[model samples]
Target: MNKWQKIIGVVVILALIVANVWAVMDYIHLADTAGAWSAEITQKSFFDCIFSFRQHFWFYTFLSIIDLVIIIVLFICLWRKGGKQ
Candidate 1:
């Protein structure tokens, strides 16, 4: 039988990589869409882009938090499983 824990670990790493890449891609897109996520309010000042940036990245941030929790939980489970062997 396969070491399911090892498989799960590999899957976890891959999932994290994919998630972070996706987040970064969207971040780039959002920034580009927002003109580098900043706009001129005056010759020397930029408009408030914080809210828009936050709004754009909120879902990705949430997914990262969820991924963190899942990774922690999976590691705990795998550790216990390994210990039993």
Candidate 2:
């Protein structure tokens, strides 16, 4: 695989890992709070205002699917390379 592609793959993989961790932590916090997540008035913006478990869950799910697709493509590329001689 190309060096740049490998770097991108690693970066994306790390991002996916971080995103998963963040989503899990957010879910736990929401659960602990009994789904009473709230955003401060000062933080009221297009992205910050919406606070709901369903939204977080769906967003996480979408990211996960994208991550999986990236991983599969990376693996396929690696497999096609057939390793260094």
Candidate 3:
């Protein structure tokens, strides 16, 4: 990948991480307010909680998935070029 592609890829990765972190935090806050799911959430795995947000946050989930695919494609491209700068 060229310099700009590398920058874009990093930006995408950072955005994905930030969004997921925020989502998790927001979910935790919601659970606290619910007074019921607070205990149930502990029983569930971390990924399970994230997946539960899919329907509620479809756009975010969709964008994250697309960013992941882009990252994978970028990795493949780098591999094909034998890691040459």
Local distance difference test, each candidate: 0.73, 0.70, 0.68
Tens-digit per-residue lDDT, 5-84, candidate 1: 67987987898889888888988886665565455433322235545567666778788788889878978987998998
lDDT of 2 by residue, 1-85 (tens): 6899789878977888898888889877765554335443344442343454467768878987887898788799778777754
For residue 4, model 2's alpha carbon misses the true position, in angstroms, by 2.8
Give per-model CA RMSD: 4.3, 7.8, 6.2
Query: Model 3, residue 36: what's the lDDT?
Result: 36
Preferred candidate (TM-score higher): 1 or 3: 1
Question: TM-scores of all models?
Answer: 0.57, 0.63, 0.52
Q: What does candidate 3's lDDT look like per residue over 11-79, in tens digits?
A: 877977887787777666655544435455453564565566556467657767877887789789879
**Candidate 2 vs candidate 3: which has greater lDDT?**
2
Best of the candidates, lDDT:
1
Residue pairs with backbone atoms closer than 3 Å in model 1 (clashes): none
Candidate 1, run of 10 with poorest lDDT: 41-50
Q: Candidate 2 overall Cα lDDT vs. reference? A: 0.70
Model 2: residues >4 Å from true position, as ranges?
Answer: 35-52, 83-85
TM-score comparison, 2 vs 3, better candidate = 2
Lowest lDDT block of 10, candidate 3: 34-43
